[model samples]
Target: MAAFVLRTHDYRTISRCLESYGLAVERSAATWPQRRFTDAAERRRAVATVTALGEDPAGTESAGYFHTRLHLAR
Candidate 1:
């Protein structure tokens, strides 16, 4: 499974058809953001399907940002 991230603004306008694949809206107040996915092929189809449904690529994300520390200051 794989999770893709997109801008919050774009997710707001995602089409319902695309939601069938995987649509989990993130709460603005959430302390930790999480994502879920079925598999690689599934996610691929989801992306393709969304485009077929006429959903803008910009608004295809259904999850929020996950906290990750790429750089740790000593």
Candidate 2:
């Protein structure tokens, strides 16, 4: 078996597809640095902050950050 991280915005759909392939999917508790905004408002606030700093929000990375681990069994 092998493990990998898949970054996606639509985890539910991807999880279903993985299940159909007989792969096990689970939310990992692994530690990693992930930048995230809790909600739309928070995201907007971040954009505003960056803009106030004279940076373009569009140039900066937007966060809808999600990751899941997959264990593939052979």
- For each of the candidates, the C-alpha root-mean-square deviation to the true structure, in angstroms, is 13.7, 11.0
**18-55 in candidate 2: lDDT tens per residue?**
78898777655442324666788767765665456444
Badly placed stretches (over 4 Å) of model 2 are: 1-34, 59-74
Q: Considering summed lDDT, which 10 consecutive residues are worst modelled in model 1?
A: 65-74
Pairs of residues at least 3 apart in sequence or in different chains that clash in candidate 1: 10-59
TM-score of each: 0.31, 0.35
Best TM-score goes to which candidate? 2
Candidate 2's displacement at residue 60, Å, is 2.7
Encode model 1's per-residue lDDT on 1-74: one tens digit a residue. 22233322233344343455575433232122334445766556555554565543332323322221111111
- TM-score of structure candidate 1: 0.31
Per-candidate local distance difference test:
0.36, 0.50
